[model samples]
Target: MAVSYSFVAFFNSISSSYSSSFSKPSLGSLKPHYGLRVDSKNSSRRLVLSCSSSHMDSNSDTMDIGQTQVSSTAPFGLTMSEANMSRSSCKWQRVLLKVSGEALAGDRAQNIDPKVTMSIAREVAAVTRLGIEVAIVVGGGNIFRGSSWAGSSGLDRSSADYIGMLATVMNAIFLQATMESIGIPTRVQTAFRMSEVAEPYIRRRAVRHLEKGRVVIFAAGTGNPFFTTDTAAALRCAEINAEVVLKATNVDGVFDDDPRTNPNARLLDTLTYQEVTSKDLSVMDMTAITLCQENNIPVVVFNLSNPGNISRAIKGERVGTLIGGTRNSMAART
Candidate 1:
């Protein structure tokens, strides 16, 4: 099905609001507070909203959870089972979701795909509702890659890397916008400062954002030229003290060889950090793999195209290849 015009128009109408929110240095700069306003005329599906701030306000009090104001529009409604499911899924308090640039493209030939973006936003919202604090690090290979263009262009390597960094910022903004449309609060922070667009990356502030249930998007690739975004993912994951790094990719899991090319190649359900690095596995860039290894952060490489896989990984359900960590003692039985 073709992407809906309503989705596009809704995003367009609020583009200025998002821009203003991120571009300014004060929360008060955002005139007319923005909130998720769902159009119920479409269907019964639940909607998620994204919210952002023009500035960081450390003094603001957290939203009260138990306070319920009477709404004249509708009567209260909730099922005990539904509430149980919500509570059970809230175990994961913090996570870092790493999405490659291609995942954002959806079915489009290039650039950001609105449908895919919205779908991801909704999935993130589902886990957030469960009380999981989420932070995202997105790649920019979909729009452009430094290595891909280096052969033809006269641009220096560092310049190309910087361009790639900027591309990530663009992707972050698109994601922030999409999430807000659904009523999910979000914050975009960059290693490189662009006051007109986002806040400068600060570890304390990022953690505070997560503490407030706000999804934080880290961009600009560590503010360095030689590093890949994968390394940035590792760095941010460590900085935020995330329990696991979910590397969402096209493949379901890591294999001894290219599964598509070698029929005998087997999918590795689990692996140790040393095995992955010593064997030169392609699960992630060597630099990123090394960083995760040193930090003892397990990496879960799974197919993002699979619906609900992100949430599954978060719940520690063993859906993908787990690398660079101590294996469970039950391995001897298996």
Candidate 2:
């Protein structure tokens, strides 16, 4: 599946409208007054109706949930030159973005912050425009952590993990909403069955979605207890055949010691699986690192707080720690 004609039209409308239409609005509050018009004959194909201006007719229909309505002319905040970059500039054709639950919380440790999610959506939009297939695995730590809450709340580990899985679903829905509100087409797939809200996780269907240029968000943490989202991310990456795992975090990269505790901690630009495990460095849980190492999947740990870092990482720029990348590949990036 290639980029649909409707999506191309939507992108063109965005490029033109931003240059001539109304002033800029905050990303979080942006509501373009166009509705998603799906051709019944081709249900798989999605079309985004663009709004010419900020003002819209009162009777005009707006976006509906479960449907994609792209309202912004310049939703990604990228210049024409940047958006027009060739697909060859993107190093990896398909990649998995592992977003922690806390990343969506902004400066706090609870709740979903719209501004943070909006920023993430923008970065994803930019890459999708360049023909990259993105699959995301988001964590539930911001809303719930089974391991921590289990002991404190006196709930069994399995029950607590189920609650945490639900938290990931909530985050996934919020992220999908934010992305689709812009010009990006997104789908939410849960590990367990939840047909009413999202598609059940199917490997072939997920690959089809990515091939069709839709960003797929995998929620529910592998549909099992006792496994972390980090492990879920690694598993999904291997299942989807993602070239790399882009682990977006608050920290700049992996450090020799805990950066928070050691002010003099040094950032490690590159490391092998052996070094990460032998050093007991917390780049990811041992399970995740082992999965990636065995499957030959590289993981890039980077600071999500920095604007454009997502784009930079996808472009193979040296923005953060690269674990499991070969010397030749690391040199090329530098």
Candidate 3:
């Protein structure tokens, strides 16, 4: 069925009035927030569910958690649940997805690609349907790169980064809207207080959201300057106790050389944390890589060109580069 005319409006209610507006929703909370049905005009069965959000006003047409209907047209070869069940060998049940702003940019030189965002939302919905908890840390390079302005605009590096963090908030909300459009339960939590737009980062509360099968998008970086979203992703992953981190980028996987510039660069199936650190592979910032290594959390680097790749990566497909852990610092090379 085609998605509805959009259901929720999060800005302000979620982030602005968090202190007074936010309340923890029980996993089986039955507080009914009126929901909509999206399916064939004549479909007999319709789903109704309860959705919880901070400062949900007296509006009937708002975000709600309902049994999602699988589109007859699957994103890949199978439906969301089928794709998930197909991955009985999946190593991690809960994972943190790190998405670069550029990944959502598609062929354009700038701005968020609606197509890419919706595709990602669909794939995420698929994973959640499988009952695998999912959280995300999205970057802001597409809207504005903090460093780009810091160096060129003569702005303080600290303030420039704050701007970049705000950019991420924009990205986060956009993603939230897209996901909700498709009936996926979702929330946006931020490192800093953007009370009008996102909930301030609360570790336990964030975990609760995921436990309820809601996709939590962590935004605003670490709420500190001089830190990339990668660091934020690592930090959130550890706090949430995720099994692994899925680093989605433009490239299909980790390559020996810059695939865009060097044709000889070979796709690496796997590598150790020590190998990435020792060789200084450009997969992630050294700090982010070290954090994951110290926590023993494996990283899966994959391309987000299509919706299926995200689940395929989580399903243990050898789609992208799998960075190794401490137990084995020496594994597949290229």
Task: Per model, state how many residue pairs clash.
Answer: 12, 0, 6
Can you tell me which runs of candidate 2 are displaced by over 4 Å? 1-85, 327-334
Which candidate number maximizes lDDT?
2
Model 2: per-residue Cα lDDT at residue 163: 95
Worst 10 residues of 3 by lDDT: 325-334
- Candidate 2 lDDT over 1-334, as tens digits, reads 7999999998778656653333444433545554334433454654434442344444544444448555343224544455446566677889999999988899884498899999999999878877789999999989999988886657999999999999999999999999999979899999999999999999999999998879999999999999999999999999989999999988899999888899999988899999999999988999999999999999999999999999888888888899999433543443
What order do you get sorting by lDDT, best first?
2, 3, 1
For each candidate, what TM-score against the reference?
0.72, 0.74, 0.72
| Predicted candidate 1 versus true structure: per-residue lDDT over 1-334, tens digit per residue | 8989999998978766554554544645644344653323432453324343554466533332335444332111334455446646543567888999988876657698887788789889878776678999999988989767765658887888889999999999999999999888999999989989999999999999998779999999899987988899999999999888889887888999998999999888899888888898887788998899889888888888888888877776666788865444323311
Tens digits of per-residue lDDT for model 3 on 233-258? 99999999998899999988888888
**Runs of candidate 3 exceeding 4 Å displacement:** 1-89, 325-334
- Candidate 2 lands at a TM-score of 0.74
User: What C-alpha lDDT do the candidate models reach, one value each?
Assistant: 0.79, 0.85, 0.80
Q: Which ten residues in a row have the lowest lDDT in candidate 1?
A: 71-80
* Stretch of 10 with least lDDT, candidate 2: 19-28
Itemize residue pairs with steric clashes in candidate 2. none
> How close to the true structure is residue 62 of candidate 3, measured as C-alpha lDDT?
32
